[model samples]
Structure formats: structure tokens, C-alpha cells
Target: MAADTAEENGDAASCSTATLSKDLADLPQDVFLLIITYLSARDSVACRSISRAWHAAFTSEDASLLLLRWHFSRSRETRALVSGWDSRSPGTGRESIAAVFAKVARRYHHLRQAKPRLIEKIDVVQEATHRDLHRGVAPWDRILRWNDNKAIFQYSDPTWCMDDGLLIYPGLDGGQYVAYDLETQRRFHVPFDNADKTVRRVRLACGVLVIEWCERAPYHQLNEREVVHRTFATAYDVQRAQSRSSSSRSAKLAIVRSPSDDSSAWTIVFRSEWKIHFLGLPLNATDRFFSTHNGTHYALYIWQPHRSPWGDDDPIEQLAVWNISFPSAYRPSLDPAGTKRPDADLGPSVIQRLTWRELEIIGLRQRHTPAIRELAMDENNLYVHEEEHRWLAGTQSSIFPPRHHTVRCTGFPLVGIGPIWYDECCADGDVHMSFCPRSGSTAGLSFADADAEAEAEAAGNRAPTPLPLTSYRKSTWPGYAPCWRHEEFPYLTVSDMKDALAGVRVVARQCFMVEALSVFVMPRISIEADEDADADTENPEARFADEMWTELMGKGRIYGDERWVVGEDAEGRITIVRF
Candidate 1:
């Protein structure tokens, strides 16, 4: 009789709890959203385990919604969960916020361990003619393809993109882009968005390029076969008496292109290599260069290097920013300052801008103590993103540690042990260098300051601080900032070409970023507190794990040993569970 009474009490308690939770569930969505909004990531994840009915209530929403809320709430685990959902949703992006939340909330620790750095980028096209008033050229040229391959003899650098496990070399002319696989020797030309212009000079950073192009025929389009849509800036320029040629071909272009079209008159603009230390993919890159005309919207999209192109990088939603078009009369092909124009030269300088996304992604590796496995940047400092290794001076023999060191000219910093920053801080050496905690920190230097430091390499002097490097703008989350942005005059979109810009339009500057990563964790994970599991500094891993549990209901597996660990779900959710 006593046992029966106890069982009845427990059952009654459960029923009452379930009934109350059910009532809470029935409240207006805004009310529920509001009620739950105040909860911490830990509390929110715990809510799902509140009761079976509550689980049914919250778990019903797409995980992304909750994850999004988590991000807004500044939950690192929640951000990771939301990020894991990246490229997962096809069109609508997500269905059930609860489902998305559940998927990542569980791995909140992993996300914190494998936190992604927000890379900033800038793209500008410089232009010159009987036109505007600016000594320093901005990438802003209204570039299009011409008819004959011989017509435009100029080119730009290759901006790197990923597709089908092949590296996309987006140059001024798609004809020159080379695709190859380490496993397979397969190679192919990356189709141009516009077929009319020929490539000239090109520069690279983080496996990308800062390219310059010369116009060919009226309607030159590279990546015509690509699914993206674009818009231009100017219909016609009034350079006193410049004539408006047949440019109807420039408007209403198609997406796809034929292979044999023989991209007309393309050449590389210039190339460059990365200069700043980095990890991950890259933050932003000078990998690609540009310019534009009046009233145009130019945009540069950065692609993440993933195991599977279809799975890792999203086709859309990766674009950095929009800008103006390339100007009418500047060309990298032409020699500086009235040099005699060559038959091979494209024309006078038109537009000049560099997207710095490569540095952002590549920042992942250099955040921690590194072992130089392999890494590479582009030439000309335009753009660069690559992974390689080199020898380093060590106490023992030349030892290749596990971590890697990196630098990108685009501008960003990270530290880590693994493939991303936040892994380890290596010691200083002739070739190998690491960050040493200092008493004071400074800011305010330009990319040019880095250039000057390089020029003074013989002197071995400390370079000035750079504001842009420190200017990274974090998401709503803290410690995440300084995303570079460079916009052009006129903003263009695919829809605009279909509806507006029928005859007149403008172009402006654009921004992009490079995303670098390290195999290292930005912050320690799963460190638990003995006194209060809610707060502990010694055990980052425990804290990470607990935080993840709170976001994900305290479930999931751990990786590595006590010394090191990593967690990324099959869904690409990163979890860190260290004891």
C-alpha cells in the first residue's frame, strides 16, 4: 500500500508538469518566443528535456529558428549550430527552428571548439579616362565581353571558388581558368561569366586572384553558364564626345555558356601572395581585383573550400557585398602613365579593386602554435589562399609540429592548434614565429603599412598597427568583429537586370572575405567548474561541453584524448568535449 501510494504521487507529479508545459505551449507563438527568449542557451536546451510534451512542443520547430535565436542571444554554441545549418537548407534555408536547434544545440561545444572566424572583404574596380578625379585607382570598370578573341588582349587575376571538388579560377576570361584534382588529373576551363572580354594580368592570394580585365566585344560575359545573375552601372559615359557603341549585347545576358565559344582576348592583370599570418581558409583576399563605372553594383562571392563542394559551401548567401561597375577607360594591360599601347595590351587602366576574403578564411591556422605542413599564397599580393608546410628552427632538429603558421595580405588574425586559429601559439624563430602576449596593444595601420614593413624586411623593425586588421566587425556575438566592407557606387542585382537597368545603370565597389581555419579551438572547451558547473575557467572543454549540453540537451560524444579533442557531427556540427 505504501509503494502504491508513492508511485501514484510520482505519476501525478509528471501529469501536472506535463499539463502545465502544455499550457505554456498553447500560448501565442510571440509569447512563447518571448518567454523562451529570456532563457540562456543552457536553459533553453534544457527546456526540450522539460517534459515529453514540452519536447514535442519545442522540438516541433525547425532547429534553425531556435539556433537563430541562440545566435541573437549571443550563444556561441547556438551560433555554431546555426552555422552547421549553413548550406544544408536548399532554398528556404530551414524548415523547423527546433530541429535545427536540436541538431546543433547538442554540439554546441563542438561549435565553440571549432568556432568560425568572420572574414571581411573589399572589391573595387579602378577606372581612368577623360573621366573622374582620383589619383589612386578604384576598381570600377564596366567590363563586358567583345566578339573576337583578338579584340581584347588584357586580363585579370584568378579569384578562387570551389565547385565539384575542382578549384574555380575566376579570371577576367573564363577560358584560362584551369581545374585539376589531386586524385584525378582531370582539368577543364572554368566557364566565364561573360564571354566577350579576354583575360590579361592576374594576381592571387589564398589560391585566389586580384584580376584586371580589358573589354572585347559589346556583350562579353564570363560564367554565362553559371546560375548567378548580375547587373551593370552605366548605360553610356559622356566623356565629352565618346561614342556609345553597340552594347545591346551587354544587357539581358544568359547564365550558361558554351565551352568552344573561345573566350575572346583574355589576359591576366596581375597576381599577388598573402602577407599576413592566418589560419582556416582565408578571411578576405586581394585574391581578386576589380573596378567599376558610375551607378553600378559590383559584388564578389567567396567560396569555402570543403570536402564536397555541393555539401560544404552554399551556392548562394556567400556573397560579401555589392559595388559599382568597372570604369570605361583604365586597363592593367597598358603600361603606367601614357606608355605606348601594345597590341597585346588591353587598354588604359579602367578599374582597380581587391577583395580581401582570402585573409579571413586563411586566418584559422595561424592562431595557435603551428607546424608548417604546407601553405601558399598568390603572386602580386592580389589574392592568396593555400596550405603547405616548411621547415622551422627549433630547439631540437627542424621539427614539423602539428599546427601550421600562415599570413594573408587581405588582413585578419587568428590562433589555434589544428586547421584553424585558436589552436596554439608557436615560439619565435627565424622562419617560424608566434604571438607573445604583450603589456600594451596598438592599432591604426593600412595595408600599405604591411607593404612598407615588407620593404623594410632587411631592417627588421616592428610594423605599425593596422586599423583594418583590427576593424573586423563581429556578428551580433562578442569577440567577433572587424568584417571588411567596401561598397561601390551603383548596386546591381540579378533582379535589376531583368526589371531595371534595361538601358541605363551604374556600378560601384564591392566587398568579400577569405575564410581561414585552424584545427585548433579558438577558446578552450568543456572545462567544468567543481564549485559551480555553471561557471569554470580551468576546464574550457567541460564548460564547452556543458554549454553544448545546455544548447543541445547534454548529449553527444567526445573525440581525442585528454590532451586534445574535437567534435564535428556528420551534419558538420563541431562539438568540443574535453575533460
Candidate 2:
């Protein structure tokens, strides 16, 4: 009898708990919304899809949800919307209210006025402006096609036309590097030889021209070791060198240019060798140099070997940032004993490495490896095209399988590794560019409401009009202060042909192939950050992920236009694609 009474009490307690859970699940709509409003936009959308009741309960009737509804209505494709949304963190719950309103307003403005159009489709024709090369025929075609057969003027590499109106070419033999100035009508030849090692590739950014020389070690028939590739780099100040002479392209030893001063002539910024074992495939590394408000940064994207748990060498790709203004202490000669220098001044230069493990919540266990195509940085942003590959099949074997690549444009905060925004497109590459209007190109503040205020002021109705409380107006409101010194003109206008000329547009010509790429800044973009932006001393990859929200005030905000010009071989045509 005592045992039966105890069992009855236990069953009664279990029944009560079950009844309480059901009652809570059946809570009234008003009370449930109070709890749901705190959830993230993504989670809120997910919760609303759980059941018919949930779908009915969650509506855009809530004023705070108005912006979210606008975004969804514009982009019904959930995947695209989510992909763009993931680029930045929408603060939890009510904190995102103001941000959402700002986004909606921006979207309205973009749709209303910034309707991009293709103004002109001019063909890139190479006319025979110079008579020496060919008396009658257009020599551009023949000269560009010159190869080993035409030994006197052999040139196989495609000409790289930079935005600064300069052309760079890698000669066929004997460390012969050529630079031609279109403005001065001068040509320069520099014999950049390194113990007979060939320059495999080159990249130019800011005023620094980085030359990559690579040589393979001799092979031994009986050896089972992997192939060893030795690589080295030498940076030159090309801008100063260009301004040095207007007559002839003379062969010079070194141009002493400083990163702090563009007026300084080309300088040898020291040389460093790269030692790494390569797999059977050829080693492919791409690098870029860009100047931010704080300092010049170089990003080297290379495939490196990572040891797996099973002691096997797995390829790990990395994008490393270095300060080009300072010499690297990590060079082999700096520390011959291979000891770590804890007190070394890595400085604001080549100092940080942003890894996927540090950026993603999944950490290093991610299955796909991202193939970085290129690195682009502006005064307030760093952008990269990250291509993630996935195997077609799941197998336990050691052999590699066929894979597919998905390209994504990832934007990082100006100061850290945390992503500020992300966008997915069905394109092969991604790049970012910004432009400030030429003086008096458009009406004052053509892209802002301040233009109306200026007109009101001119009419003598200066009632000290109050600024809009929206984030867009507050960012540039008169007397409004920022944590950093903002640019005098930070936005772009593309409504008219003049605005198009003031900015840039990119179009795709299905025929041409892209041979060379570059970006240029008129006058020059400032590399000085604000006092507050300079206060964060943490490594880019070590900062708290939450800093992404605080650092990225406006997501999907870009200035000017990014255009790519691709050169074609047969027709000598070029295609420009704008981003």
C-alpha cells in the first residue's frame, strides 16, 4: 500500500509538468510577440515558418518590421537575401530598428535615382600613331604578336595598361622589364636579374611594384622528396621613377622611394626569399597592395601546407597582410636561429593574417577550402573574392575529387577580420572602387538632401532647418562629428552622363579575355585614420566578433564604381564590367 501511494504521487507530478508546457505553448498572441520581438531577423523569419499559427501570428504590421518587409519584398530570393544579410550582423531586436529604416531609405534613393545604364560601348582600337614600327600597316597588331620568331622585337606578354596612363611589360628574356609612359612618350628598360632566376609574375599598387622571381631546385632521379620552389620579392617605387625623366627610358640600378612620401624616387625595399615545398601542381600565388587611411597593406594569397591529424600534408590556403612601409623581421636573415621575437615591432604594416577559422563560427573544421582570387582595399574597407570549393562526391579515399567553385564578395571592417558585409553574385571575379566627383561636376550635394537645404539657404529662408534623424543624414549633418575624420565628399552620383563620367561603369563583352588589372586614385586617397579608429590595438583576427556590428555602421554602402577592362587577342577589343 505504501509503494502504490508513492507511485501515484510521481505520476501526478509528471502530468502537471506536461499540462504546464502545453499552456505555455498556447500563450496569447500579444504575450508571444513580446518574446519573439527579441529574436534575430533570420531567426524571426525561421520561427514564423514553423507552423500555420506562427505564420499567421507574425505579420509586417509591426512598425519595427516594416524595413525587413521592404527588403524581403524587393528580393524574394531567400538565398540571395540571406547571403547579403550575413555579410554584417543586424543587431538583435530593437537595436536594429534604426538601421533597418536607414537601409530602406537608401534602397529607395538607389532605386529612384541611381538607375545604372550603359552610356557608350566604344571599341578599343589600336591605331598606328607611331610610324617607326610600321611605315604603312598598323604595327600594334604585329608588334604585340612579335615572339621568338621575330627575334629583333620579340614581345609575347600582353601589355598591362594601368589607370595612371602607364604601360608595363615583362620582356621575353634576361630580366628585361619595360615601362612605357604614354604621357611623356618615353620607354624604360630595367634589367631586374636575380642569379638567373626568372620573374614569374608582378603586381603594382599604390606606388609599389612587387616583382616575384621563382626558380625550381634541380631534381634528383632517385630522390623521393617533393619539389622545392624558391621565390623572392623586390618592391620598387614606380610613381617616383615615372616623374624622374621625360625623355628616355634609361636602365637604372635602384630608385630610392619612401612609402611615406610619393615624391621620393623608386627605391629597393629589400628582398626576401620564400621557401616552401610544392605539390605536383604548379604553385600559384596572387598578391595586391593597397593604402588604407592608416598605412599601406599588402595581401599575399598563397596555398600553404597544413599538417592534418593523421600526419598528412593537407593544403591550406591563406591571405596574409603585411605592412609594406616597414621591413619584415620574420625574414630568415633577421632571425637566423629560428627563434620567435616576442617584442618585435610588427607595426601597422604586414602584421595581420585573417583566417576563415577566426571569422566563421565553425572554426577550422570547415570542409571546404576557399580560393582567394584577389585583395582590394579602400580608405575604409578591405575586400576579397573568396571562392569556396566542394567535392562532388563523398569518399574515404585519399585521391582528390572533382569540385565546384562558389565565389563570394567578402568585405572586412577597416580595422579587423570580422566581416562588415558580404554579397553573392554569379560572376567570376569581384572588385571595389570609389570616386570623388571632379570639382563642380554636378549641383552641390547632388546625391544628398543637403542640396535642398542649400537651395533653401540661398533663398534666405535659413531657419536653421533641423537635420533628419535618419542615419544617412546624421552621418553628414552639419556640425555632426564622427569617430574618424570623414572625407569631404564620400558618396557617388551616377544619374546623368556627367555623373557617369565623374564615376565609372563596367560592362562584360563575352569575347575578350582579361589579361591585366589595376586601380588608381586621383590626387591620392588619404591613409590617415581618425583618433578613435586608431585606438583599437588588437590583432585583426583576435578581435571579438561582436565588434563587427559596432565597426560597420552602414552595410552594403559603397562609393563610386569598379570597372574591369578585359583585352581580346583576335579583334583587339576590350570589355568593361562594372561592380
Candidate 3:
């Protein structure tokens, strides 16, 4: 009995000494609680295994540790949501958006069932993501304010363009142009020496900025009286900071100009040929240039609308290839074949040049087709807008097809070419176009006697023409929800074009009037491990692996859709939607 009592006394002494020895007893209980409150739910749960005090503090409802833990969990969840997109490249903790949403949904489901009041905050965040699967609210619940007023042109109207994660426009104080990177959050400004020059046009492609302007010559000088139009294209080197360790702020980009230019720090990649014309129309009317590679792949598009209504002699669409040479400083990671080879040749120097290869448009367009409404191009495919015609013979006025809001892509018939054509185009010297299958009255109906006689008799002397199977390619979005509205032509952003060329497959169907932004999460199809390994046999799955197949992800915007929609509200505050 005496031994047992002694042992009990010794145990009590050890507990006292251990608690006081670490100076833990000197700290206030509230301070300890506050420290643990900042930890994530996973870490807080782990603390419960540490000591009795930590367990007690975490369990207390009045301390609100449960609420803090939940907040931290949701913050982690939001990051997961952003990173859950189908980037194809691995090493992101999660795979697809659907997986991340499912995991988060299950977590909140359990939390709501356990503690109703504690989950109110999580519910608000959930509502933002889940509110409208069809109608996307502004990116995040808040508006992105552009604090730099110097970049604005007219207080009422702003002229800016966002493409491939870049925002470019002339600064509010004319002659100054600003290019902001969406991914890196880097800002770059280029100032024109002469403020008198009028900025005519601005375009951003493959990380290169091209500005075209009319130089205002002094009226006193007779020889230089005409406004000379010129184009200046520059490539910027955005060096990301090494300390990506900071949690709150993204990496700051430092724009470094090449050593070669006298007018500005930026490296001059290309200069437009000087042209003097009395009339507005010039021979070199190159309106737009499409490039997916930083230094490799390029295509120049020359717009030619119909001149004569009845003639079909001249081809309406003409596409040509261009070889863009980039200096070593402007090495783009996305190769012509869509595979991202970051270590690919940056080029020999910071100076770049573009050489054009002329080609005739053939085997693409049919005769008597309507005029092209809009044109979109990437490294892999070209999206051309055409009118939709729906002809129903039985109904009056239905014999003619519908003539509005129809668009088709050029690389559809080819199976896996849409995603990986960049690499293939660079490999071979051939460019291919997709063909649309014919459908209508005579389609699928054989005129061989028996059925033809019955159909003609049933139709009362006039046989109905069979409808053609000319439906828009629905396979682009395989698993999209039927409820979501569909748009014939959703405005394709520069980022969208870059991503498509880089092999990030998406079934992009813009919802009609509602402007529904539906981002499909395509899961990487898994291959069976137990398949027979015959070295001679070809892998069937490999052929279709890169094909664009969209899996139905719950209605939400995919991560990289961070382009801003800028506008002015009633209070004169610039309203921006950062989606």
C-alpha cells in the first residue's frame, strides 16, 4: 500500500515538472488557443494527439476553433479547385476538376450533417461555385478594379484586348502601351517617343506585342506630309522572382528588354514595311496574324470578302504559313506540336524575324457558301463561322435552311489531330482541312423501286427530299450536361486559342444568350495494366489518347479563365469581371 502511494506521488511530481519546465504554464491559455486556431483542420486534428490542453482548446465551441479550422479547410479547397483543371501535365496533387469537386462536396456534406451553424461560411463559398452552372457570375464574387488610370484611353470607353493570358492597350495618356500578364501578374509599359503619333491598332500573339500606328509628320515639310503607317513588334522577357515561397502574393515579374534597340528597352522582333497610299486601302492589308509558338509556328491570315455575287473563280479563304524566328530571350515553351518543351531552343539571339510562305486555299470551302462571319485559328485547327440551314419539306418556308449563328472547325474529321497537330504540322509539310458530310432529301433513301414507290404514293405524288446529316460536331463536348444552353460561336479568347494548340482539350460550347461559360473537365483515360505485352502489336489507345473528349464536370469555370471584362458603372467606377 505504501509503495502504490509513493508511485502515485512521483507521477504527480513528473507531470508538474514537465508542464513548468517548458515555460508552457507561463503562457496564457488564450494565446495557445489562438496559435492553434491559425492551423489547418488537418494540423489542428493532429494537435489533439499532442497534449490534453490542445485537445480541450480545440474541442471548445466558445473558442470557435472549429470555425477557424473549417475556414482554413475551405481556403485549401479553393486552391484545389483552381489547380484541378485538365492541364494534361501531372504533379498537381489532384487529377481532374470532377475529382476535386467530389472530394470537397463529400467533405462539406459531412460537415453540414455534424455542425449546422459552423458550416454557414462554407455554404456561402459553395454558393459562389454552384450558384449558376449555366450562368457564370463574375469571377470570384468581387469585381477586379484597374487602379492604373494612366492605361485608360477615354474615361467613357476603354480600348484594350485580352488574349492568351495577356491584356494589352494604349495607356490613358496616349503614346504609352501597357501589357499585363494574367498568369504571372506582371505589368509592362512601352512609351512612344513622339506623342503626336496616333495609335491605329494593337495585337498580342504568342507573347509578342505588335503595335501599328500612323506617324504624324510636320505639315510644313512637303516630302514628309503623308502619315506613314508602321508596325513595331516587340518581345518581352518576364523573369519570375525566385522566392515563390511567399504564400499571399504571386511571383512578381521583372520585364527585361533585350540589348539591341535604340528607341526603347524592348527587343524589336519585326517592323512593318513602310507604305504610302493616298486612299485608305493599301496593298499590304494584313489585318491579323496567328501564332502559337513563341519562335516557331506562325500563320498570316488575309481577309478577302466576296467581290462579285455570282462569281466563284477566286477562293474566298486564303491561309499562308510564316516562319517566326525568336531570339534566345523569348523562347516560348509551347512547341508547334502542342507539347510544352520548355527547354527547346530559345533561338540564337533576342532579335526575331518573320518570313512568309504563300499557299492557296483548296479542298476546304464548298461553292456558293455564305460569306465567312468570323475567323479563329490555332496551331492545330481553324474555326470558321458559317450560316446554319434547317430545311423541312413538309412545312411551308421550312424548305430553306436557317441562316444564322453556325460555325465549324476545320480539323474535326481527323481523330487525334485537334490536340496534337502542332507537333504534326511541324513534322510534315502538309496542311489538311476537315470535310463536312452531306445530308438532306436524297440522303439514306435508296431510289430502288419498292420503298421508293411506297414513299411516293404516301406523299401524294410529291416525294419529300431527305434531310442531310449536317449537324454541328457534338463530340467536341462529350459529357456536357443537356440542361446547359449551347452557343454556336462563343468568343474564343487568346488564352483559349493558345491552350487548344498546346493540347489542353476542351469541348467549348458557349451557351447562347445567357453567355454560359461551361468548362469541361476531361479525365485522363486509364490504360489497363494487365494487357498482353506483344512488342509487335500496336497500341490502339495511344491513337485516341490525345483526342479531345470532354467529361462532364459540374457547372463551373475552369481555372485559367482569368481574363477581365472591363466596363464603367453608374458611379464612374470601372467594373471589371476577372473570370
Clashes of each: 299, 14, 23
Per TM-score, the best of the predicted structures is: 2
> What's the lDDT for all of these models?
0.27, 0.33, 0.29
lDDT of 2 by residue, 1-579 (tens): 889999999999999988777642266755664565344344455554677756545533342343243322222111222223221111111223333433333332222222222211223222223111111101111111112221111112222323233345443343255654432335555435544444444555555566554444432222243343344455555543332221211211011111222222233333222222222213222121112211355555454444355646545544455555554435432333447433344422345665545545412222233333335665555666433322211122113422322335566554555645665422121123212122222222123444675577478652223223341332222121111111111111101111121122211111112111112111100111123344222211111123221121111111122222223333322222121
Using all chains and alpha carbons, the TM-scores for the candidates as numbered come to 0.28, 0.38, 0.36
TM-score winner, 2 or 3 = 2
Question: Per-residue lDDT for 1-579 in model 3, tens only?
Answer: 999999999999999988777643235766655454344444444554567766555444423322322232222323222233222111222123223323333333232222111110001112223221111111111111123211110011123444544555444443255655543444566433325443343445554544433333322221232222332223333222221121221211111112122221222233212211111221122222222223333333333333455654643444433333444433121122325433333432212221122222322343233322233444444443322222112111123444322234332211122231111000111113111232111111112333553466367632122211222123222122111111222221111111211112122222112222222211111111112333222211111111111111122112222122222223222222232
Badly placed stretches (over 4 Å) of model 1 are 1-52, 59-94, 103-109, 113-189, 192-579
Q: Candidate 1's error at 70, in angstroms?
A: 4.3
Q: Give the TM-score of candidate 1.
A: 0.28
Q: Rank the candidates by lDDT, best first.
A: 2, 3, 1
> Could you tell me how far off, in angstroms, the CA of residue 534 lies in candidate 3 after the best superposition?
44
Scored by lDDT, model 3 comes in at: 0.29
Angstrom error of the Cα, residue 396, model 3: value is 25
On the 0 to 100 scale, the lDDT of residue 335 in model 3 is 26
TM-score of 2: 0.38
Clashes, model 2: 14
Q: Model 2: which ten-residue window has the lowest total lDDT?
A: 520-529
Q: What is the Å distance of residue 206 in model 3 from its true position?
A: 3.8
> In what order do the candidates fall by TM-score, top score first?
2, 3, 1
